[model samples]
Structures are given as C-alpha cells and as structure tokens.
Target: MSHSMRPLLPNSPNPPRIETSSSSSSSSQHRTKRVATPAACEACRRRKSKCSAERPRCSVCVERQTPCEYTTLPTETHLRAQRRKLSNLEIRCQAYEDLFGILRSRSEEEIAQILQRLRTGEDAQTIVKTVQDGDLLLQLSLKPEFRFRYIFPYSGEMPRHLKDAQNPYIRSLLYEKTVTHLVQPPMYIETLKEISDESQKMYIAPYHTVELDDPRISSMIVSNWTTVSSDNPMLRMLLQIYFVFEFPFHPCFHKDFFLEDMFIGITRFCSPLLVNAVLATAWHGYTRMKNRAEYWQPHNLGYRFLAEALRLFELEQETPTITTVQAAAIINLVYNLNGIDELGWVYTHKSFGMAQKISLFTPNPEESTEWQMVAGVTAWCLFNWQALITFHTFQPPVINDPPSRPLPDVDEEPAYYGEILVKYPFGKEPVRIYNGSVFKAISQFRVILNDITKSFFNPSRTYSPISFEAAIEFRSKLRIWYEDLPQPLQARHIVLPCHLKIHIHYHIVLISLFEPHLHTDNAYNGVNPDMIVSQSRICFETLMRIYYLRHGFECLDTTLVQFLHLLGFSTLDEISVTENGSAANEAIRSTLMLCAKGLWEQGQNYYLSEAVFRMLRQSMSVEDVTILGDIVEVEDGDGPLNLMAQELRSRWPIGAFSKADDSKDRTLEHFIHWWQQYSEEKAQDISAMEQDGPVVPPRYPQRYGT
Candidate 1:
C-alpha cells in the first residue's frame, strides 16, 4: 500500500503505538482540571490550534506575531436583557412612526381607534395605556400645530423687544425635554422642574433639587433611596443631607423626631461625615459654649444625648489605646452637666461609631506609647460608665418586677472594640494616652455590674438577693487591676482604692437610685419625713467620715484635705475647750460618736440603730485624732435615730448580727431577727461611708482574733 494511505494496526510490529494510545488515555483522565479550559484565540482558531489567554500575545500568537481574541459564553440573563432592550426600541420606533402618520394624515378618529386597539394588546407601548394630563401636555409640546397656542396663553400679545423670551410654558416644556425626559421611570418632568425652581427661590441655596406635587411622592423618593442603600459616595452624600439637614434642620420637622429618637436617627441614618460633624459639634459646643440647657434649642430636644454618651463609652472600652483622657473628661463633663437621671436613656441604644473607634485604637505593647494607653483607658472608662449606668438603671426594675415589657430592645450585639480597629477610609484615629489600666479597671467594674445585674434578673431561685455580692466582686476586680499597676503610675494618677468602704458607698448610692424606699422599708408608716431626712444625713455623714477615716488628714494629699476642711467640715471641740489636756482623745471620741449617731438615727434601719449606739457607749481608745477635727454635721434633726433604736432593741439584740456566730445556729426566727438588724446596720454603714467619702474601720482592738 502507499505510505499516505496506510493506517497503524495493533497486531503490527509497532507495540509502541498501542502503548502510546493507552498512556494518552491515562494522562487525560489524571490531568488537573480547570473551571473551564481556555480555548484557542481567534488568531489561533483561524490557524486551528491552542491559544493561551495571555497579555499582548498567546503562545501561538506570540510565535506567529498575530493578534488574539478570547471569547466567553454570554449569560442567559444578559442575552435576555439585550433582547428586551431591542424589543422596546422597536416598539418606540413603531409608535413614533404611527404618531407621525396620524399627524400627517390628520385622521383623528382613525388614530383614536388605533390607539384604543394598541392599548388592549399585550405588546403595546407603555405610553399608549390611559392617556394622563401630563401626556396631553407632552403632546402639545410635540405637535407644532398646538405648541405655539399652548405656550402663549393669550391670543396675540407678542412684544417685538422680547423675541428671545418665548412663552413660559414652551420654555418649561423645552427645558424638561432637554434635561430630564430621557431619564427612565417617567416622572412629571415639568413638576420636578417647578419644584426645583421654587426651592431655589425660597431657600436661596443653589443645589440639585428634585420636586413633586405630591408630598407623598417626595417622601417615597427619600424612603426608596434609603431602601436601596450603598456605601457609594453618592449614596453617602444623600444620606448626609437626609439625616443632618433635611431630617434635623428642615423647616418642617417630624413629630417622631423626639430628643432621643432624633439622636438615634442621626446615629442610624446619617453618613459617617455627618455623624462625626454632629458629634464634634456637640462635644466641642458643650465643652466650650454652655450646657445643653443653653446650647441646645427646644427643637433639638429629641436627640438621645445620653445614649450617645453610652455609645462612646462602649467604643472606648473595646479599644482603649486610641481614646484619650480628654475624651473621658469631656464625657464625664457631659454626664455630670446633663445630670443623668434614668439608666434606660443610657441603655436605649448602642453605637457603631464607638465600636469603630475601639477597633481603630486597639493597643499594642511594643508600638503603643504611654499617652496612647492613657487615652485608650479614658475612652474605655467612658464606654464602661455607659454600660454601668444602664445596668444600674435596669437592676431595680428587674429585681422588683418580672418585666412590665420585654427589656427595651436597646443594645443588642454588644460590639467588640477590636472589630473596628482597622484603619478607616477616613484617616481619623481616637485620642491616645498613657496608662490604660484605669480604663481596664473601669471596664471590668462595669462588666462586673453587668454580670451581677444579669444574675439578679435571671429566673433562678439560687441567686442571692444581697447587693453586696456585686460590690464585693467589683471591689475584688478593682483591687486586682489597681495593685497590678506600677507604683509610679498609681502615685501619679491617684489610683482610687478598691476598699470595702468605697464599695459600700457606691452600693448605697446605687440602692438609692434604684430603690429609694429601701432606705426606710423598716421605718413606721414608710412615709416619715424624719426618716427621709435621716437617710440623707446618714449618706453625707458616711461619705465624709470614710474620707477622714481611711485616708486620714495626714494620709491624704495635704492640699486636698485642707481644701476639704476649707469647704466646711469644721471640728466641734477646739484645743482651748479641752483644758484637761485630753483634747485628742476627747475629740476622737466625739467624732466617732457623731458618725455612729448619724448612721443610727438617719438610716431608718432598726438593727443598725441599736448597734451604732451600743458601739458608741462601749468606749474604745482612739488612734486617729485627725478624724475628730474633720467631722461635718448631719444638718438634720435626730428623731429617726431614737425611733429606729427603740424598734430594733425591742425586736433583736443590742449588738450587730455577726454572721459567723449566727450561721450554724441560724433558724428562720433567728435569721429574720438577725437580718432585720443586719440589714439596718449594713444600710447605715453604707450610708455613712457614702456620706463621709472615707469609711472608718471600727476602733476596738482585735475583737475577731481574740
């Protein structure tokens, strides 16, 4: 046979041909597969071979130096879209031709019948549906016959000098056609133009404007734009205007824009630029100008200032490195100035901005400087204070009631500071400062409160009702963090001591805020004016006594102690009055007596009432003479004390209930009796400490050890 016509057979002497075919099949099966195999380019296709989709040239194209083009399969949706567009264009052209024919022939009745038939058909033009008033207006503009008559309302008042100034109606029609007619979703173009013109005239602000005769239409446009939100520049600009200006500053403000609601809306609806602007303005304005009463108008009352503060706090706690002491100070100033009355206001909402700040300012030991850490701590404290206050506010309601309503859907998905720590598109970062321990401590304290608050609310019978548990936990955490800090930082910052007394003071304050009635629950009639005044007196007395007791006048920064003295904590017995040279001891006795009396009488707890007087009568040597000179008067009368003591002594022991002595022997009767006294005693002690600012340890020598 000829060589050209010959074909290889497996039985022939060439065994390699059969093996090659087997190998080829095996390799094909084992080959790594791509999503789609790249095909030969057009240039390579013409030559009939493989082509790699490479830049400048594919392998075949490179060698041959020919142009290459890669082809991809069009998606089904894309092909459908293309066909639909073509079909619509065809319909538009047909309608145009039909209309022109009707106009040219002047066949009005025939045109009407054709239009009616087209309207009933499936593939008719959208404009052919029922003709609207706007359609008539459009037809007048399009038909040269009606155009002049429609434009000039009057019969014949054409002025030769105003030739260029054509009819107003004609001018409007032409302007709309030129500028807006081609845009889709056919709006009343003339109406929008009129609104634009009117708004410009009234507001005197030359900006892009969209108008509609229907207020609902304008609202729908605003609402729809919000619904189709994107992180694009145009969308952000729209959001800024809608939130900051249109929503807040518009002449017609909505009633839904309550103070808290307005602020919440701004936080939710505004662009980041608008948020930052409002925040900076609010912060700087509050700090530099006047308080909210002066700076904020009645119209601005609906913004939730408290919630924003809480948001700031949450942000700081998550990322303490970037937030600063100044930020904390500013927040503190705001909080105090506003005189935060309810916890719910603080708890109502969380903040993304705060969360973002935390993430951006996350701390690193090697990279972070001291100032940065301080700022971070400050921010952290601000966040914790927010949560802490909210938690505090919620605790009482949770304790007293199951919940009148489902806990306000305020904060959900409590944001982690680290989540937002990445660099933002805007090159803004939180304030940085040194020593983040304060922030950490405050954060833990708030967290402790949160845990306790939650525990109090949790539907568990085993949970203790004692408020001290939270205080103890908070004190423990505070101590751990405080002690761990370097001594220099502590000395410089005046790190607050997390002692029993300090904890007690807060406990009373919290109780007062949450359940003021708890102060006089045991008192006769529960509405005693004397009891109320006494409770107030005890609170002040305790706080002041603690200040002098724990950190004596000598222990305190002398200037601070002197300042306190100057502020009006005058001593009772002068050096000249104690001629017996027992001035120090007598004065110390009198100070302790005053503190005990203040706590016993003012605090409406019967058990504490008896315990305080008993301790006062059982004289003990005084080690701190400074306390005697540092006492402040209760300023209120003492009838509540006598009544409380009489009630307690009649019902329980004269001595305060010692838990150690009573725990094993504790019966329901004994426990009730002891608790009655203990609760009273504890309440008084806490009140005293709260009032005194420093708590005094008992003066007796080693009673527990002996």
Candidate 2:
C-alpha cells in the first residue's frame, strides 16, 4: 500500500528491490529484467516513496497513478511448522518435568519400579492417561491401604501424574475399611443417650460442614441435579438458601473467583436442569412450613438458607409468574426476614449485605421484581418496627434535662412521640429500647403476614380483645411456671425463651398501663382494684395461651394451679397453695441456713440463727407457720413462735411497762390482737422475701439452716 508500510518478516532470509524509468525503451529493458524477480512489488525496496528501476509503466506511470496493484507475500508454511514444533517440544519438556516433580513431591516411585518391588497383598495399581484419570489415580494412591515408598526419603518427594506414566506400575489402594468408616456417620444418638433426658441441644442438627458456603459443593449441587435425589430436600433447600443468602458463592465458588469474568466456567458446566432444580428446591422450601423452625431459629443452617433463598427469590421475581402461588411463595419467603430480628441474629451484618447486593440489580421501584424484593425487604423492616413498638411498651421513658413530667396534648404533635401508640416517657429509654426492638420485630411479622395474605386474597386477622386477653394470661403463667422451674429444666421446656419472656413482659406492662381499658369488669371506672385484678388476669391468660400454643405438652399442666389460684378459681388437679408455700418456705430456709453457715465459716460474728430467723419470718405465712407445728415455739420454750416471743420479751423487758394485773391484762389483750394482725400482714412479706433468693456462687458450699 505504501513504501514504508511494506510487510517485514523478522525471520525472512532476503529482501527484494523495485525499479522505474521514464523512457519506453528503458522501461522495456527494465520490464524484461524485473520480470525475473519472485517477490511482489509490495515487498520490494523503494527509494523514498518512488520506485527506481523501470518496468512496463516506468516511474512516470508510478508517479501519476493513485493506486498501485501489488501482490502480498505469503507466509512460509515450513518456517511456521518449524516454530510450532519447537513450541510443542518446549511444552512437552515442561510437562515431563512437571510430571516428574509431581511424582517426587508425592514420594512415589516410578510405576515400573513400584511394580518390580510389589509384594504379596499389595494394593492395585492404576495407569491413566487423562487429567481426570490422573486425579482419580492419585486419590486412590493416597488411600491408607496403599503402601507407597519414596526413592529418596530425605528428599521428601511426592507423586506426579501417574496417568501419564513414564513408569506404569504406581500401586493405588482402595481404602475399603477407611471408606466404609467414612460412609458410616458416627452414631451420636448413643452419646446423646448418656446425657440426662432433659437436654434440648440434642434436638439441634449435627453440623458436619457448612456445605452452603462450600463452592465445590454448591457448584456440584447446581450442576448435577439429575444425580441429586428428590428425597434430599435438605440439599435443595440448602442450595437455594445459599443462593439467596450467600449470592457470592454460586454453584459453590464465588462468582468473582472466575476472575471477575463471572462464573462462566461453572455456569457453562451447570446444565439447565441443575439450575431449575436448585430454584425449584428453594421455592419449595419457602412455600412449605417444614422450614419455619429451621429457617427462623437463630444461627441455624436453615436461617442462613432462608436468607439466601430470600435473596434469590428477590432476584427471580422480575420474571413472569404462572400463578399466585409463586407470588405468595416469594412473599412468604421474604416474610421470614421478620424472624431475622431474633437474638444472636444481626441483620446489619448478614441481611444488610443481601440488601446491598439486591440494590445493585434493583433500582427502579416500578419493576415487578423490584417491587417484590422491596415488599420482602419492607416486610423485614416492618418486623424490626414491630419489635420497636413492643420494646416501647415495657421501656420506661427516660426524660433528660427538663424532665418529660407531663405528656403533650394529643393535638400538639412532635416528630417522634406525636403518635398515641408511641407516646412513652423518654426516661425509660433502656426498657423502651428493648420494647421498641420487639415492637419492630412483631410489626414486621404483622406486616408480612398482612402483605402475603392480602396478595393471596386472604385478609389478615387481628386478635380480638378476648383473644388478646387470652394471649396475655397464657404467656404470663407460662413465664411464672418457667421461672419457677429448676433452671436446667426451664430451657428444655421452653421452645423460645426470649419470645416467651418478652411476651410476658409486654403483656404485664400493657395491662398495667391500660388497666382502665384492659379490665373485664368495667365496674371500677378507672384504675381501681377490679381494674388491676382484671388486667392482671388478662395478662396471665394471654401469656398462658401463647405459651401453650408455641410449645406444646412439655409446658402443659405447668402453671395450671398457680394460674387458677391467681384467677381465684379452684381445681381438683391443682396443688394446694398452702402445700406449695410450705415447700417453698422450707427451701428458702434451707438455702438461708446454708448461706449463714458459710458466713459463720468465714468467721462472721452474728449467729446464722438470726439470718435463718429472718428468712423464715419473711418467707412463711401463718399457714406455713402452723404447718411447721412444734417448730413454731419460742427459743426459750419448745416452738419457733415461742422462741421468737421469748427473744422479743427479753428485748422489751416484760416487767418494765406494766403496772398491776389490771393494766397488764388490758395490754395483754391488745398485744394478742396486734400480734395476729402483724402475723397476717407479714405472711405475704415473708413469701416475697423467699422469692427474692440470691444466686449462690459455685465456689460456695451449701449449708443447712440454723
């Protein structure tokens, strides 16, 4: 094309020349001479931009012409072949060295040498050609049954590519025994039996590996759907879960692991069926109720999976849907975001990451998938809101500076506390924070519940006052029963400890605050004893109902007696209050005595008898005292009461305040009446005192009462 643009070959053996002439006779002579050259005009050397030697048209034709016809040089196939052969030779040599290095690294002898050294009962040797076969052969060789020896012990050589065997007899062993053991997952069921029957952690699934995070496992799951059994719902669930929660790790490896080129390799490898199966499994898990406990329970694999599933569903919602079931399914799946507010679940760390990822693909609100994802995320957000609302009820407002002594008029709206439901004291911030969190969580639950139900044309059901009251009592009694239990047994009996406790607390605070509204018998216009008692009953019933509904028989019959007694009802199946009180008092006394003994051992001066006396007096009712029988005599006399009286008498001095028998007799009557009143009043006080027992430190030894 141009003189300077002529093709130059670095390996060329020779260069060509070109000539041009003005005269026809000179051109004729030049043409005759130049016709013998093999190379084309494009490959010819030229002086500046012009040709020198004359040809058929000469220099005048070349200068005047706008175009020059030139034949380009062809590549030398022989030279190319020679270069290719050199490259192939280099590659072959490198491969041979790599193979040798691999074999040395693995401490393996040449196949021929291994075969020559083979003894009786040696493991089988495999010779493979392909890389896959080499890998398999290597795996077989590493088995425990294979007794491979290194040529150089100190060199620490390892096996190379046995399949491309320079030597062909490297023995590979099938570790039948080891493989069998591996195949047989250990029976943790037996070890579980050794523990007391009261353990709950036993119910938690065993964690062999967090497979959802494993790239290889994830890829295999996504790419090999045909081989995956339908019965392995867990696997499918897990894959979907991972896809949603852990979007980065797809098929199993990170999408970025393909060097930001996307998981082209893995995606290419995954058949369409595998992708469908994974998605189907996820959708299935979301629609079914089987995963609720597994999904929502804090820190479980199900939770991780559910989170991932939500993400995947959010991503998938952009496409067309066949039915409302799919819509409802996706909505319900996102509804689980509400469950993320549970203890030990930090949404900021886990769920927020998913949100950010979602934001990347979803920016427009009008898009259907965006809306679906938004609805799901909003449902999650609402759950937090519900938690926040629940938190405010129990949380006392903490007023700072000019204290929030009086609430503002309903008409005077503030940004935060303007809403009647949110109007709480700023002083009780701690409790408010706790209640707020619960309110937020519950609100999210309600929101998602409403949203999904509405989508499916099923309106959400609000709890009626009666239902709400039932819920309160049910949960409160459940709490009391749970708290009354021996500590170890409590956790086992309770399904969700935080939820149970929160429910009780929330109801208690609500009833206390809204007694005027919550009371059953509106007889006492506002905040009266009837109101208090009715509100209390409402709380108690609600708590109990919720507890029973949430956790079944393990908590059944638990607070039946205390609950009936609180409600002023009697039941034949109930334990007598007197019996319970007596037992409680005895336990309290025994505990106090043990504490007193410890104080005594520590060289404390006061008698443990005094502490024991205080504990009994504080914990025992007249009924308890009566049941104690002869133990109620004075210290100077035979009974506990007499003993106490003797001590009082000694302190007061019986003779100092009395005149003759007339004054003494009147005083005696007054004293007896006063004593009865005091005993009656002190009974409840004592019971309360025992209930306020301390947690004994482990290092302290138990002591019997004084």
Q: How many residue pairs clash per model?
A: 48, 104
| Global lDDT of each candidate | 0.32, 0.29
Cα lDDT tens digits for candidate 2, 1-706: 6466778769757664364545655667656553333322331333234443344433544676633433322332334646767876864554443334334322234544434433443432221123223432332222211121111111112212212222111211111111221221243333333434322221221111012223343223222333222222234344434343222111111122221121243332132332332343343223222223233344433344344444554454444222111222223322322211222123222332343344422335454642443233333342333233222212111110111112222234232121101111111111111222322233323332222222222123321122334334433444454354432223223223233443343334334333323335433223343544344434444333333222221111211211222121111112233244454334333322222222212111111122223322333334433433433332322243323333221111111111112222222223323444555555557654476554221111112111
lDDT of 1 by residue, 1-706 (tens): 6457667656857554445887898988878864443444567668767556564467778788777665532332334556767876965665454344333332477457656766677333333322222222321122222211111111122222222232221133222342234322233233333443331221111111111121221112122122222212222222232322122111111111212233344432122222332332232212111222221233231133334434555555554322222233333323322222222233222232443444423444453443343334333433444444434233322122121111111123111111101111111331111112322333444555555555544465333343433434444555565456443234222212222122332333343222322433333333343343334333333334333322222110111211121112122222223443364534433444444434323222112222333333222224322332234223222342333333322212222111212223312123234444654675677667468544333332212111
TM-scores, all candidates, are 0.24, 0.22
Q: How accurate locally is residue 76 in candidate 2, as Cα lDDT from 0 to 100?
A: 28
The alpha-carbon RMSD values of the candidates against the true structure, listed in the order shown, are 29.9, 28.8
lDDT at 404 for candidate 1?
A: 16
Top candidate on lDDT is: 1
